[model samples]
Target: MAPAPSADTLGTSAARARSAVLEEQIREDPGRFRMLTGDRPTGRLHLGHYFGTLHNRVRLQDLGVETYVIIADYQVLTDRDVADTLTEHVEELVLDYLAIGVDPERSTIFTHSAIPALNQLMLPFLSLVSVAELSRNPTVKDEIAHSRQSAVSGLMFTYPVHQAADILFCKGNLVPVGQDQLPHLEITRTIARRFNDRYGNGGTVFPEPDALLSRAPLLLGTDGTKMSKSRRNAVALAADADETARLLKAAKTDSERHITYDPAGRPEVSSLLLLAALCQNRTPEEVADDIGSAGAAALKKTVTEAVNEYLAPLRARRAEYAQDRAYLHRTLREGNERARAVAETTLAQVRTAMKNHY
Candidate 1:
């Protein structure tokens, strides 16, 4: 007899299946879907974020999906010691969202700190999940390892539960995620399932959200490793044209005179090719073919030009938005009010379902 498929394999298979159906449904009637996705306000937004998820958020919103973006300011405390600059980071995030075509009129953008009822749901969600299960979450483990801290905080351990609340508080039924993040969504789905099974009273209070996997390949940093702000390999979306060219000038690439698109064999060269391809909406191979025998200098120049041109309009918009801090604040204020109202409704339903509506 054949051995059973592993749990990870089963999960991946199930996610792909659900995603196919979700895509078809979205095509037919996008307004029927509500998407929940966001970022931690730890640092400035970068190219990795733009291509990976930000662009997708804009596309979905344009397609008529109900979009909600949370700044996740509270999540930064999981590993960091202070939030003194938290306010600045939140405003910068809002600017980045608006500059990238995330219209406030269409998509709701709010911060975790602004939604009390949303955080309140965490208490009950915590009860539905176990300590062992939380500890077993791979994404949580990866975060803890990368944190390089000697001791882990209880809040850090319960990070996934909070994420579940972030999604379920607004009754979100669709979440855009990468493959690595599926574990976090799985726990969220589990919480939704257990909560409904225990307190649903034969009627579901929360919908189990499915993962809308990102189609974009991971864009690495200039140093030929993962694109990260701390690593200083990432290109910030707010970087000026001169700074962008200067950074690309020093990018890592092999000494081969001829360029080729072999990510596994020539990651450094291939990474630059991928960047140009993404900017031009062409394939990496096509970019590589165009730069044949031009060597690393020409490749770097091509990438810099592509990146600077692509980001010019976004950076222009960001600069304009930055000049008006009052508008940014007002946007947040309005988003928070809208999010709170939604959370209040969801919490009220939870109270009714659990027979605690007194």
Candidate 2:
């Protein structure tokens, strides 16, 4: 009968404790962790995607973490009116993922709509979360404003619950997310805990996932604003050598000319340096020092060369995969089967816990 807790307070204490536990976990055995992360199939992935999470995803797979990448196709419909080109968008996304080292053999890559069981889990998860709590979700609020949509859909409002289903369906115990998305993960943790406390038979039904913060620096767009597909500031992974060069060369830089690693005072120049440093696995300050007195033009050239060279191998692999449409389809088919298998297991457990497994 009492009011549900505010969104901000959902999992603050648990998240903090989970962070600590994960920190110690990595020290002991990182392979024991399972992670889930992905993006909406809006368009081809850009440099922002690469530096933000893709690179870390590849490393996590190499380190032997059980990783799952979800192409959130349903989430894309929250604002999009016409999905006539959604098929093309999903295909392009798969190509980008494969091109950027998201190995299907090493990690499971499945589309959200493809896993029906995952969606079914959402019905129960909804009951564990409240409308007041969902309404206060910070990520949902920011997304609505960013998309410039005046009306909210039921699916959009209950997005965090869907996300909870995604994580819990895979039994994902670790999620690599940005600081801004902490609240979403907090909601996921709260749902998992609430379900366990209410329905779990003398034990927890779901393991609350913890946040694995990325160390990559945020990359601003060419215009010094947030890099996004709609803004046309992103450099897609599928871009050719020439296209990549053109995008980088045209990126904004201040008139003062000389390059420095002052993010606060010179964000444009600093953004370029950050890209170059991340590409070459060096520090931004070190890259800045290496290009001392070289001016903005020189810095742009350095960054362009590094980015093109860095993507050369990936682009080649992408080209090959893009041509083999059958292979891409097969990859998805296999991933969906694997993902559904896991989802079924988890869903069965959930139904049993809630006394609906008769």
Best by lDDT: 1
Candidate 2, run of 10 with poorest lDDT = 7-16
lDDT at 78, model 2: 85
- What is the overall TM-score of model 2 with all chains considered together? 0.92
| CA deviation > 4 Å runs, candidate 1 | 1-6, 356-358
Indicate the residue-level lDDT of 219 in model 2: 94
**Model 2 segments beyond 4 Å from truth?**
1-24, 356-358
- Per-residue lDDT of candidate 1, residues 113-167 (tens digit): 9999999999999999889999899999999998846788889999999999999
Tens-digit lDDT string for candidate 2 (300-334): 88998889899999999999998999999999899
**TM-score for each model:** 0.96, 0.92
